[model samples]
Target: MTERFYDQLSKDFEEMVSWRRYLHQNPELSFQESNTAKFIADKLRSFGINVKEQVGGNGVIGVIEGNHPGKTIAFRADFDALPIHDEKNVKYKSSVDGVMHACGHDGHTSALLAVAKVLNNHRNQLKGKVVLLFQHAEEKPPGGAKFMIEEGALDGVDFIFGGHLATDLPVGKIATRPGPVMASVDAFKITLQGIGGHGARPHQTIDTVAIGSRLVTHLQEIVSRRVDPVEPAVVTVGSFHAGNAFNIIADSAILEGTVRAMNSNVRQQIESEIRAILDGMKVADRIEYSLEYIHGYPVLVNHKEEALLIEKLVKETISLDAFVEKDIVLGAEDFAYYLEERPGAYFHVGAHNEQAETQFPHHHPRFDFDEKALLQLSRIFLQLANHYLVTD
Candidate 1:
C-alpha cells in the first residue's frame, strides 16, 4: 500500500468536505435523526451498499460484504448533535436554531461516508464483511448504542472500531490507549420537600434551600474521604433550584449532579456512600426528600489487540508522531456500550487548528473542528479494513 491509501480519492475527499458542511448546517438532536438517517441511507444506497433503516430509533446500518469470506468487523459513527446553538461565524454555520454538531459528529459521519465509498470501489480486493453503524442519541442517556445492540447491530460481528474527534489536539495526530480511557458516569437527581412560609414567619417554615445547600456541601465528602485515594472519582452538583420570589420561601428544591469513576468497584462504592450520606442527613426541622440515580455509560476500555493493531497501523500509514497515548478522561461516551459486549477499540481524531482558533472544547457553542482531519480519519478506516479483510 502507498503512504496514503486514499491519495487517489481527492475528489471524494472534497465531496466529503461538502457533506460535512451540509450536515453541520442542518444538525439533528439525539434520538430524533430522521432526516440524518434518511440522508445516510440514501448515500449508502448511492454507493451500492446494502442499507437497513430504523434498526434502533433512527439508526441506519449499511452492509458491505466482500467477494471472499473473513471476519465480520463493525465500524460506527454517531450522527446525533448536541442541544447547544452554534455560535461560529462561518458561512456554513448551523441553520437549525438551538441545535448544533458541536461535538464533531458531523465530521465523523462525513468521514465514514467517504470511507464507504472508498471501500465499495475496492470491494473485489478484500474478504469478510464490514458493518457500518450510523448510530443516534449518543449525546443523551439511554444511548442509541444500547438500542442498536438490542436491535442486532452487533450480530455476527467479531470486532468494532469507533472514535471521537478531539478539538484540543492538532489535526495531524490520533489518540489511543488501552484499559479505561474514559469514565463511567452515574447521574443523580434529588428533590427535597419542605414547608413554605412568608419571610417574616421564619420560625414557622422549613427552608429547602438551606437543606439542599447543606446536602450539596456534604456530598463532596464522598469523593474526598469515602473513596480510595488511588481511585479516581468525582461528584459534581451541576444544578440547584429552589425559590423564585425574594420573600416567599419555596416548598421544594431540586438538585441534579453526576458521579464519575474509572473502576467498577469504586463506582458502586461511591454510589452506595452517596445514598448513605443522604439517608443520614439530619435537619432541625423535619424535611422529606427523594433520590434517583440513573446508570449511564460504562467506562470505555480499549481491547489490547485492537488498540495495538491501530497503534501499529497509524505509525505505518500516518507518522509515528501521530500516535499519542491519552490519559484517562472523566468524560463519558456511549461507545463504551459497544465495548461492553465486543472486543473493540475507540480512538480520537485530532481536529484542533491553531491558526483558525478552533480550540474550544466539545459541547461548547463556539466549538469547531478542523475539517481536514476527516481525511486522516478516512485513511485510517481504509487501512484497518484492508488488514482485517485479508483472508490469506
Candidate 2:
C-alpha cells in the first residue's frame, strides 16, 4: 500500500511543484497571510476536505475522516514568509516586494496540500481522521502555533507531527532525535541612556557607543563564562544604533538581539545574568538603562515515544541509512507550543541537492530546496496519520 501511494505521489509531483511555485511567487508576511490562507483553504476544499478558516488569525484547518471511527492525528505547516526580498532570478521568483518564502514554508505548505489530496483519494481505506493545520506567522513572535492552539487546533488531537525542510541536509535524508531538538528562543533589548557632549572631550561625554560596545562583549561573557559549559546557549546582538553625528557622543544607544538556550534552567540563568549586567552598567556608568526581555518560544523537546515513532516511519519509507540522528540545534521553533499540549515530534527533512544548487541556508533571499523533498514529506505525513489514527 505504501509503495503504491509513493508511486501515485510521484505522478503528482509536478503539480505539487506548481502549487509551491505559485505560493513562492506571491509570498506574504507574518500575520498577513490572507491570500496565502485563501489559496490553501481553496486547495483543501477542492480535495473535499472539511475546511475551517480563520483559525487563530489566518490559519486554515482541513479535517478528513476515514470510513470508520478511530483516533485523530494532526500535521502542521507554517505558511508565513520572511521579510526578505526575493534574490533568486528563477522563473517563479517572489512577486511581493520585500517578502519571499525564503524558509521553505512554501514547500511545507505545498507538501501538506499534496498529502491532503493523496489521502482524500484513499479515504475509504483510511482508518481514522487527519487534521491539516495551515499555520501563519511562524517567522514572527507570538507565533501562529500558539494562536492555533488557543483556537483549539489540538482540542481532540491524539498524536501530532510536523517537519522542516533543511537545505543543509542532502535530498533523500531525514534527521531526528529524542530530546531537545531545538533551543528556547527569546529576545532582549537594552537601551542605554547617557550624557551627550563633544566626542573630542575626554570626560565631558558619557560616550554611549563605547558603553554599548563594551556591553555587547560583556553580554557574551554570560553565555560563555557563566552558563554551563556543557549547555548550549547563545547571546548575540544583531542590531546596535547610537548617534546621528560621529563627532557627537550619542546620549542614547539601543541594543537588540536574540537569546537561545537548550533548556529552561539555562534560559533562566542567562536572563538573570543579563539583568545583573544591566544593573552593573546602571550603577557603574551612572547611566539610565532599561531592559526588555521577552520569552518567545520554549525548548522543542520531542516526546521520546513520538520520536521513536518518527524514526520507525523514516526507516520504513527510506532506509535506515537515510535516517540520521542529528545533534541538538540552537534554532528554536514555535512548534514547541503544540508539543506542550500533545505528543508530537518535529523532524528535519532534507531538501538540499548539490547538483541543483538548492543549498542556501533558510531566510536567505536565495534560499530554495529540491522539490522532490516535498513528496517525501507528503509520504511521511500520510503514513504518520494512518499509523497514528488506525487502531489495531
Candidate 3:
C-alpha cells in the first residue's frame, strides 16, 4: 500500500525534521503568520483533517474527504518567513530576530504536514477530495497567492500541487519543467527631476546625478539591446539614489529595480522599454520624469498536462533518477497566482546536501535544508493524492 505509506513516512522522518526545525526556530513575517497559522491549524486538527481558519489573513485550509466520488486535489504549502536574519548556528536557530525561515518555508510547512498525515491515514483508500493549502504571505508583496485566490483558495480545486526547496537542486533531486517554469516579476520606480546646483557650478543646475547615471546605463540597454536574445530578460538596477552633498548637485534621482521575464511578449516589451527610457531623458533642456511600474508574479507556467502528470507521478512514486527537467528561472512565484487560476504544476524538491549541510541559497541569511527532503515531500503528497483520485 504505497510501501506502507512510505514506511510510515520513514518513521515520522525524525518527527518531520523536528517539525521542520521548530518552524525554523520560530520565524514569521508577511501578513505576520499568527504563530505560523496556529502551528498549521494545530497540525491540521491533529490530522483528523478538516480545519479552515482565517482564510486570507493567516491562511490555512486542510480538508481531506474520500471514500469514493473522485477528483479534487490541491496541496500547496508556503507559510511565509524572511526578513532574513538567523545566520544558521542551527540547533533550531532563529528565535525570531529579523525573522527567518529563509525560505525552505520551514521545509514547505513540514512537507504539507507530512501530507496531512498520509491523507488522514489513507482516508478509506481514497477516491476524492484533498485540499491543503496553508499559504501565508509568500515573501510578501501582494502574494499569499493573491490572498488565497481572494479568499476562496481555488474554490473547488481540481488539480494542484507545489514544491520548492532547492539550494540549486541536489539532495535526492526532483525538478520539473514544461513551460515558462518561473519568471515575471516586474517593479520599477524612477524619479529624476532636476534643478539643484553648486557642485562647483557645472553650468549652474540640472544634473540629477547626471540623470540618474544615465538612467542606469539606459536600463541596461533594456535587457541588452532590447529584449529578445532568445527571450529571457532581466533589467536589475536594484536601487540608486541621488546626491546628498558631495558639494551638492542633486534635485531628485531615484530609480529602483527588478524586471524579469520569460515571455508575455517579453513582459510587454520590458514594460514598453521602461516607458521609452524615462521619456528620453532630456536633462539640460528641462528635466522632469517620474515613472513607477509594479507587477509581480506571473510566469511559473508549468501545465503540459500538468507536466505529464507530474512526470508519471514522479516516475511512479520517486526516483526515476529523481525526475529531472528544470531550468528556466529568473525566479518569481506567487505560484504565478496558482498557475493563473488552475492547471497546475510547480515542482522542485532537492534541498541540497553537499556532504551533510552547508548549502544556503533561498533568500539567504544562511539558508538551510536537507531535512531529508521531508520524506520525499511526504511521499509526493501521498502520490499526488492517490494519483488524482484514481486518474481524475
Candidate 4:
C-alpha cells in the first residue's frame, strides 16, 4: 500500500512543481500570507482532506482520518516568504516586489501538499489520522508554530516531523541529528545617549559613536571570553548607526545585533555579559544607555528516537548513502516550538544542483533549490507515515 502511494506521488510530481512555482511567483511575506494560506487550504480540500482555516493567525490545518485505529502523526511545512526581491532570471521568479520565497517555504508547502494528496487517496487502506500543519510566519519571531500549537494543532498527535530543503547540500541527500540541531535566536539593540559636539573637540563631546564602536567590539568578547569554550554561541553586531555627517560628534548612536546559542545557560550568560559590559562603560564614561534584548525562537532539539527513525528510514526508503549526520546549525527555526511540545525531528533535504544554478544560500535574493527536492521531501514524509500507521 505504501509503494502504491509512492507511485501515485511520483505521478503527481508535476502538480507539486506547478504549486511550488505558482507560490514562488506570487510570494507573500511573513504574517501577511492571506492568499498563500487560502491556496493551501484550497489544495488540501481538493485532496479530500478536512481543512481548517485561520488557525493561529494565517495557519492552515488539514486532517485525514484512516479506516483503522492507530497512532496519529503530524507533519509541518512553513508557507512564509522573506522580505527580499526575487533576483533570479527564471520565468517563475516572484511577481511580488521586495518579497520572495527565498527560504524554500514554497517548496516545503508544495511537497507536503503532494504528500497530503497521496495519503488522503490511500486513507481507506491506512490506519490512524494524519495532521497537516501549513504554518505561517516562520521567518518572523513570535512565529506561527507557537500560535498554531496554542490553537491545538498537535492536540492528539503521537509524533510530528518537518524538513527543509537545503540548497547548500547536494541534491537527493538528507541530514539530521538527535539533539540541538539548531540554535536559539535572540536580538539586542543598544542605544547610547551622549552630548553632541564638534568632531574636532575631544573633551567637549561625550562621543556616542566611539562608545557604540566600543560596545560592538566588547559584545564579540561575550562569546569568545565569557561563554565556555566547549559551548557553541555567537554574538554578531549587524548594524551600527551614529551620525549623518562626518564633522559632528553624534549625540546618540544605536548598535543592533543578534545572539545565537545552543542552550539556555549559554544564552543567559551572553545576555548577562552584554549588560555587565554596558554597565561598566556607563560608570566610566558617564553615559546613559538603554538595552533592548528580544528573545526569538528557542533551540531546535530533535528527539533522540524520532531523529534516529528518520536516519533509518532515509537509508531504507532512499539509499544507504543518502543519510548524512549533519553538524548542528546556528540558524534558528520556529519548528523548535513544535518539537518542544511533541516528540519529533526536523531534518533537511538537499536541493543543491550544480547544473541548475541552485546553490545559492537561503534568504538570498537569488536563492532557489532544485525542484527535485520536493519529491525527495515527500518521499521521506510518506515513509515516516507508513512506518507508524498500518497499511493495507
Identify the runs in model 4 with alpha carbons over 4 angstroms from their true place.
Answer: none
Tens-digit per-residue lDDT, 275-322, candidate 3? 876776663446888788898887878888887787788877665888
Q: Indicate whether candidate 1 or candidate 4 has the larger lDDT.
A: 4
Clashing pairs in 2: none
Each model's lDDT: 0.88, 0.89, 0.82, 0.93
lDDT of 3 at 82: 79
The total number of steric clashes, by the backbone 3 Å criterion, in model 2 comes to: 0
Give RMSD to native, each candidate. 1.7, 1.5, 16.6, 1.1
TM-score of each: 0.95, 0.96, 0.39, 0.98
lDDT of 2 by residue, 233-265 (tens): 999999999999868889999999999998899
Report the number of the highest-TM-score candidate: 4
Clashes in predicted model 4? 0
Model 1 Cα shift for residue 33 (angstroms): 0.9
Stretches of model 2 off by over 4 angstroms after superposition: 390-392
lDDT of 4 by residue, 1-392 (tens): 66897899989999999999999999998899999999999998887889999999999999999999999999999999998998999999999989999999999999999999999988887789999999999999989999999999999999999999998789889999998999999999999999998889959989998888888888888878878999999999999998999899999999899999999889988989999999999999889999999999999999999999999999887899999997998999999999999999999999988765698888899998889899899999999989998565
Clashing pairs in 4: none
- Candidate 4 or 2, higher TM-score: 4
Q: Which has the greatest lDDT?
A: 4
| TM-score between candidate 4 and the true structure | 0.98
Off by over 4 Å in 1: 1-4, 282-285
Among residues 3 or more apart in sequence or in different chains, the pairs in candidate 3 whose N, CA or C atoms overlap within 3 Å are none
